[model samples]
Every structure is written in C-alpha cells, then in structure tokens.
Target: MNEDSTPQSSTEPARPSSGWDRELLEKLLLEALVEQRKARRWSLAFRVFLVAAIGLGFILAFKPLAQGGLTAPSKAHTAVVDVIGTIAEGGEIDADTIIEGLREAAEAKGVKGIVLRMNTPGGSPVQSAYVYDEIRRIKKEHPALPIYAVVSDLCASGGYYIASATDRIFVNPASIVGSIGVIMNGFGFVGTLEKLGVERRVMTAGDHKAILDPFGPVDPAEKQHVQQLLNAVHQQFIAAVKAGRGDRLKDRPEIFSGLVWTGAEGIELGLVDAVGELHQVAETVIGAKEIVNYSHRETLLDRVIRQLGTSVETALTKLATSSPRL
Candidate 1:
C-alpha cells in the first residue's frame, strides 16, 4: 500500500488541538490579572500627580495675603514699596501695582513709613499721572504715615511726577533726576517716500485724524495743534510738580525745561530733598531700622498671560495712536 493513499483510523478520537490548555490558560489568566492590577495602580498614581500639581498652582496664584502677605513684620518696621522700572502700563512699575502695594502697606500692622525705591527713565504720562494721583490720595488718607521717594538711577520725567507726590525724595549723589516736561515725538518718512517716488494713500473722516502720519507729509497746522496739546500736558505736569513740591522747588528757568540733573544738583535745584540710601532712610524714618518690601510681584505664568493680552491690544492700537512718546 502506498503511504500517501493510506486512510486514517475511524474509531480513535483525534487528539484535541491546542485550545485553552489548563496550564497555558492558567498562566495567561495570571498574567492578565497582574497587568490589570498594574494598570490600576498606574492610573491611580497619574490621578494623584494631577491633583498635587493643581493644588500647588492654586497656592502660588493666591498665596500673598491682603495686607503685605508676602512678608510678616515683627515690629513697626519700615514698609518699603518699590517703584523700580518704567512708569507705564504692562511694566513692573505701574499705577495699579503701585497702588496695590501702597494699600498693602497701609493695611499692614505696625508699618512706620513707606519707601518708594524708584528707578526709571520715565514712561506714559497718563500712567504716571494715575500713580501720582494714587499717591496723593493715599497721603491724604494716611496723613501721619510718611512716604519717601528714594531714587537709585534715572528718575526722570514721569518718574519725577510720581516722586513729587511723596513727602520727600532722596537720591544718590550721581543719580539722574528731574525731567518735568511733556514731549511728543515721532518720525516722518514723507521726504524719503517722495524721493523714492512713493505716494502714501491715506483717508480720514476728520480733519485732524491723519495728523502725524509717518508716511505722509506733515501738515503744519496739525503740527501746531499737536504742539499745543503737548504744551497743555506740560502745563499739567508743571502744576503737579508745583503742587507736590510746594515752596521747596527753587524758582529756576531750567528746572522744568526737560533737563536732567545729578542728585547733588537736584538738591541745589530743589528737585530732590536729600542724598541718602535705602537703609539710611529707613533708619531715619522708623525706630526699628528693619525694612520689609511690599511690592506687588506678578507670578511667572501671570506675567506671560498679561504680556500676551497687552501685546494684542498694543498691536491693534498702534496705528491709531501713532502720536509722540507721551
């Protein structure tokens, strides 16, 4: 008989194929159970991690208390508020933040005096005015509490406007101080465009709408109007200075002529009261001589979000507000 043609047995049951063998099945079941347990543990761990991260973020966002929560004072320490940076919206130093810090100092227990550690080359006139108003308001509310402006570097223009509201201003000998002036400055590319054979297409509904368009010829009438506007603001600045400084300011022609002077000259010119440092001023103001900062600091995440919003708003308003610097 050919082996290829041989038939299989009929009565003998064929051995079952490998399906769900007891040992193999048991092994697989054990592995699956173990994997499920591990998966559950990992899921629980991930959930726990998320919860912890969220709680931490919340603490960071709202940790500083209402009354100088950043630091607790032991005695009647000199509460210091920093006005360090350009006095403008969206900067480290601004009306809102400065006022917030001032409020904190006002509310803080046993705060002897408030020191404004100012360092700025000036910025937005409106922003500076806001801060100045707040300072005056605070001073009015807390007449007994002394507020001092201690300049570190360039305390010019708007910086001076804010400082003028303080009880007294102390500056380092070489510090640049004073710029009690308002200015409007921008560039005109009309001549360049004309030479380049380019025509600027502009349309406005109002006569003075396109007043200082950089790409077009500057209208003399518009220029005069803008100068008058600057002079008005300058007058306001001068009034603020006079109101704040009172009779301390010397009657000098160059005092408010947009000229900056050294701290030593500022004293002679009566733009500044005295020459001193933070520690010395603190010691002079408060009995304890211990100083505590009460500045409103933006968190890292908060700053990023603020900048994003500000950048978008500025981009939208840039063309509309192409006027001078403040």
Candidate 2:
C-alpha cells in the first residue's frame, strides 16, 4: 500500500465522492419523481373519465323513466298523448308532435283508445288548427276507435281548440275548460320613444307594411286592419268549435267570448261531455285499464336545443310581427 493511501475494510466497498456520481443520483431521483407524478396524473384522469362515463350511463339508463316514454304496450291499453305546456311551433307540445302521437296511437295494435292529456294555457292558433284537423282526420279514418280529451288543470284557447276535435271531452270538476277566442296584443312605444328623444325612421315598399309598429303612433286605418284580422281569426276559431261540438254546445254567447269556465260549467255549456279524470276516462270510458303513453318525449339535449330555438324564434317574431294567437 502507498504511504498516503487510506485503508478500506475487507467487507465494505469503496464509495465515490466525485460530484459526477452525486449529479447522476440526483438526475435519477428527479426522473423517478417525474415518472411518479405522471403515474398519479394518469390515475386521476382515468378516475375522472370513469365518473363521467358512469354519469352518462345513468342518464341513458333512466331515460325511459320519464313520463310518456316513446313506447306502447303489447296488450290492450289506452294510449295517452300529453298536451302539457305551451303548444307553439318548436315547443314540446307542438302540432307536429301531437299529430305524430295521434297517428302512432291510431296505428299501434291493441290501442283501444287515445286520450289527449290536456294541461296547457294554449299557444298558436295555427298550431291548434293543425292538431284539430289531424284529430278530425284520425276520427274519420278510424271510426270505431274513440278519441277523447281529458282535461287536467287547464284546457283553454288553443288547448280547447284541439280538445274540441276529440269525440268526447272529459274534465275534472275544477278543471278550467274554455278560452274560445283569438287575440293579437302589443304595446305602443311611441310615447316612450318621444320621452327618450328617439326618432324611428322606417321605410317600406307598401303603405301598410309597417302596420302595428310599436315605435310609431297608432294609425287608425292600421288599427282597424289589425282588428279585422283578429276578428277573422276569431270567426275561424268559433267555426271550429261549433263544427266539432255541434249540437252538444249550448246556445250561449259567452262560450265564444274567451271566458274561462270550470269543468262543471263547461259540461253545462256542452264544452265537456262529462266530469272525469284520466284514470276514470281510461277505465270506465275507454274500457282499458293499462294506459300506455304515446307522446313524443324530448330528450335532455333536445329540450335544451328546442328551448334555445323557441326563445330565438319568439324574440324575432316579437320584433317582426304581432302574430295572432288563440
């Protein structure tokens, strides 16, 4: 051994003190830590993905649990088409959907009868007429199959319009029955514009093009024209009700005067045939106990999109025209 050399133990190996080894060890440690962090992140991401997948599965699994799921029974049953909520174009209770449901129920095997489950404040006149016409056509095609309207909380205006087309109108004693009229309402913002010092300059090809413009002063001629239009629609509505109800409707002026009445009063006025709810109408009237829903139920995504579309459409329509409604 050299004089200055340090002696090593027989069992223990020599350890290096150079900075290179320390640097290498530190680099290895850093690499290991980074790998650990990456593994933890991957595990967390996987868990998040799993949770999201499970949530989606639950939504899909429970879709049929919603009222009036898009299905019918194999056995004899009363088909129900819900007319709940506003019955405007693009709405959940729109004419197209109602007509589709009616056609489906009429076509489906073992569907003894169809019940229009009415609970709406009513919406567009055109939409109402669409449904009413569809119901009449269905009745004409299927003379044996009885179609009935069962009013719940409310069945007014356009709602009643659709109901009138049914073979018989059943209602709860307290259910609101009628609003057989047409209206076109709006506000005149001319005074507000004057107070705000806002000048509205509008140009139109025709003289009556800007009729019922809220920002302009009410023109007597334009006002008269709008009134005439409303009256025309009102006559159409009256005609529909009279044609559907026929001799069942009482000879009363207030029936077509847009006055709402209770189910009992409606029966007296011949607006409703009897005082009965859905179950009663199904079991006693239709002679079917099992009630299968045939209504076109909207999915969550569909409802969201429909609501967005309806909002935009309504806003635009309000800006453009004060369209008549039932």
Candidate 3:
C-alpha cells in the first residue's frame, strides 16, 4: 500500500496538540471565577440591604424606641399637666388621667412646681369634682409647691371647676373662663314615641331604675332629685373656688350662675390671677429658662395605633351624623 493511502496505525494518534485548547480551558476557568466572585458580592450586598430594611422597619414600628429618654426628665422646676378636650369620664383629660399625671409631677424629684394647662369646654361635674379634690389633696400635701393654672382658648364649667383648686390661674386676654355650675343633658322621646305608637317595654326591679329613661315621662320627683344633685355639685364647686381664691373672689351670685367670662373680666372678678399665655407663665412667671417635658410620650408604634383608633372614631362620627335621629 502506498504510504499516504494506507490507514494510520490504530495505536498511533493523528490529532495535532494545539495550545488553543489549553488557552480556552484557562479562559473558561477565569470566567467562572469572575462570575463566582460577582455572585458572592451580590449576595453580600443583598444581605446588607435586607438587614438595613429590617432595622428601618423596626424603628418605624416602635418610634418611642428611637426617642428613648426624651421624656424621662421633668422639664424645669415646673411640670406641665395639659387638660385639653372635654373633662368627661374615660377621656384623656378626665379626672383619673389628670390625677395620675399630677401625682407623677408632684413625686418627680426635679419638679418643684406644677402648671395645669387648661383648655376645654368642660364636661361631667362629677369628673371635674374628682379632679378638683385630687388637686386640693396634692396642694395640702405639698404646701410649698406652687400649682398655677394657665387657661387657653376656653376653660369654662368643669374646666374652671378644676382650675379653682390650683394656687393661681393665668389666662389670655381672649381666653374664656368661669361657668361654675352643673348641667345634665338628655333628650326626651316620650312624646315622639307616643306619637309614633311605639311602646317601650322597659322593666326594672327598682322604682327608680328607669328614672331618667328618654322614652318614659319624666317624673316630677325625679326632676327634683336631679336638680338637688346638681345644686349640691354646684355648692361644692363654689366652696373649692372660695378656698382657692380666698378674699380675691368677688361676692357675686353671678359667678356661680354658669356665666362664662373673658380673661380680662376674669382678672377683675378674681376668677383669674392674671392674663398671660403659657410661654409667659413659663418664662416670666415661673422664671424657668429651660423646659423638660415629662408627659408620657407614645412610642412610634403607639402613635400609629392611636391614629388608627382616631380614624375609627372619625368613621363612627360620620356614620352617626348621617344616620336619622331617633
């Protein structure tokens, strides 16, 4: 057989040993390593970003955690106890809440005095009286600690009743004060029910169980009883004012006739000690240059929860407003 035509020996290889194969393998290995490094870096970055996001979420969830110790110190020598909104039971400015705040302020080591910030249209007489008593007790216990009441916008009725227990009352010139009286409000639906031929089947074991029921006719005896109770509350209110204001209060029945007066008139009538705002009382009257708020600060999470509750309340209010009156 010719040399070129004969098949190569089976044991001998005919392929060429080119360097391109080795070079290609090296390039693939390097590319793989680079890809691995990039993947590792991406994973690390993702982990870092995840941790940061979680931390931010926690901070947002618990705002108070971020504001740690902010409200720990009592501001200045004077602690402020804000009495905003209505002075009704179960309210933020109710007797229980105010009393607790006052007690805390009184017990705080840094607080030398208390400033009762009053801004309310007033509410339940019973609740107001409870707060008044608590204030008086605190005053008696801490005779040296001065308690000044600073009235804003409107401080009438029960609000004034509470202010009466303070050592001194300061009000802005346009602020409304006074209204030393008791009032109970309820609708009477007896006539309406009768006209509509609707019978109320309310039953009680006691004769006075339904004394103030709107669907029933108001008994003369019940009316007298309620009046007497209100009158008693009014007398207690008068006594508190007399004790606080002493000889300063003018001897006028009109003062206790549920008559609201401006701050200018109140000062003249001794219903208020002076006319001033909160800043004036804090800076000039109390002579405190720095203020530290000791009021309970809601955490970020708590504020969110409170906001949700307020939203619910607003919805309920809207629903009630839209509904037909009974």
Candidate 4:
C-alpha cells in the first residue's frame, strides 16, 4: 500500500457512536425545549390578559344589562305608585299591598318624590281607610318628600279617599273624579231559598249572630242600623274631603252627594287641584323632570309565585266558605 493511501478509509463518512449521536440529539432537543417553554409563557400571558379584559367587560356590562329598565332615567327622580282596580278585600288594591309599596317607595334612596297614579271605581270602606291612613303616615314621616296624585281614568269614592292624602291631585281632562259616598251591596236569597224548600238552620247563642245572613229575612231594626252606619261612613268621607280640600272645595253639598264629575268640572268644583296628564304634572307643576317608577314591579318569577300562592289561598278560601255551619 502506498503511504498516502493509508489515510483514506471509505468514500462515505463513518457512523457516529451511540453516545455521540445521543449528545448531539440532546443538545438540539434542549434548544427546542427552551423555545417551547418561551412560547408557552407568552401564550399563558396572552391568555391571562384576554381573560382579564373579558372579565372587565362583563363587570362593566353587568349593571346596565341587569337593571336596564329600572336604571334608565325617566326624566325625574319621581316614583309612580299605581293604585288600580277595587280597594276591597280580595281586590287588587288591597291595603297590605298599597302600604308595602308606599313603604318601599318612601324608604328608597333613589326615590325623591312619589306620584300616586290612581285608577279605581272605589271599594270597601275599611280597605280604603287603611290605605288612606298609611299615606297619611308616610306623608307625616317624610314631610319634605312631595306626594302628587294623578287620577288616570277614574278616581271615585275610595280612590278619591286615597288621593286626598297627597299634597296635590291632578286629574286628566277626561278623567272621572269624586264619588264622595259609601255603599254596600248584597243579594237577598231568602225568597229563593224558600221557593227551593231549602231550610237554612242557623243556630247561634247571640241573637244577632246571623243578622246579615242573605238566606234569612232581613230584620227592620238591623236594616235601620246598617243604614245608620252607612250614613256615618258617608259623613266621615265628606268630612275627610272637606278637610283635605280646605277652602279649595267649592262649599257645595252637591259635591259630596255621591255625584261623579268630569276632570274639567272637577277642577271647577274643586274636586281636583288641576287637570293635566301625569307627565305634564310632574314636569310642569311639580318641577320634577325625571320620573322613577316606585310602583310594585312583579317579575315573571314573582308573578308565577304569586299566582301559585293565590291559587292556594283561593282553594283555602273556597274550603272555608263551603264548610258546614258550626
């Protein structure tokens, strides 16, 4: 062999040993690992930043979306409390509900003034009187807070009784105002029971226990007593109106003679302070440009719950009313 030829092995390069190959592979793998770690950190930071931004967005949107209807300004800090339907027992305008609504409105920090929006044809004297007393109490407690009553469709009898408690009363030009009186209505079923040969055996220790029973003949004395009571209630209503209206009331007995008047005539007769819509009254007269609804709001869930409760109560009432005599 030639001396120089000893230096040449093969044309192809020799394969590296396992250890050497592993070291080279490990070095490259470590470099790749370092790059992956850096990429992961950047990814984590970006994800965290995105999450924080989304969280902030949710926090900002939460209030407006949650309380959209309630938070929106109606141009006044005034709250509207609606008094609709009958004011009697089992009626929509019950004393408890009215008092609760008024109490909430009175206590609400956001509520600056109260607008009693009345639309009723009257109801039980007791129920009306209870609401009236509550209004008076709220007024006495929050003397600085102004309470304005706006008669919508009708504010007659018991409804007017409630409106009398407000600082000012405004009625729409077409609204029906006043019916200063008292009334009691019942059907006499004694003749029908007699015709049907249905004997109503009512045994009681007290002579007047069943005095007003519709199934029995009405006693003349009992009728007279009831009439006297009704008269007394009417006089009380008259006196309350007179006291509330003061000299604003045109001194006329016809005003309290169970006569309902139109909003225009009511203004002339001093049954109402002025004739205007609720918005106009709030904006122009009261100087409260913004309106907040202090009325009791029943959500769908609340309504469902209330309906269930009402059903249960009705069932109980039916059971009680249909029960046999004691």
Please count the clashing residue pairs in each candidate, in the order shown.
0, 0, 3, 4
lDDT of each: 0.83, 0.87, 0.79, 0.78
Q: Any runs in candidate 4 off by more than 4 Å, and if so which?
A: 1-76, 110-112, 297-299, 303-326
lDDT of 1 by residue, 258-301 (tens): 99999999999899999998999999755548888888868765
Report RMSD for candidate 1.
12.4
4-107, model 3: which lDDT tens digit per residue?
Answer: 89875688767876899889988888888777766765665566556556655765666655555345364556688888898777665677778878888888
The residue-level lDDT of candidate 3 at 258 comes to 89
Residue 2 in model 1: lDDT: 93
Ranking by lDDT: 2, 1, 3, 4
Q: What's the true lDDT of residue 124 in model 3?
A: 84
| Whole-model alpha-carbon lDDT for candidate 4 | 0.78
Please list the residue runs of candidate 1 whose C-alpha ends up more than 4 Å from where it truly belongs after superposition: 1-57, 60-70, 301-326
TM-score: model 2 vs. ground truth: 0.72
Clashes of 1: 0
TM-scores of the models, in the given order? 0.73, 0.72, 0.68, 0.67
Between 2 and 3, whose lDDT is larger?
Answer: 2
Residue-level error in angstroms, candidate 1, position 282:
0.5
Across 271-323, the per-residue lDDT of candidate 4 in tens digits comes to 89987777887777767767766555444544644565565456545534542
TM-score of 1: 0.73
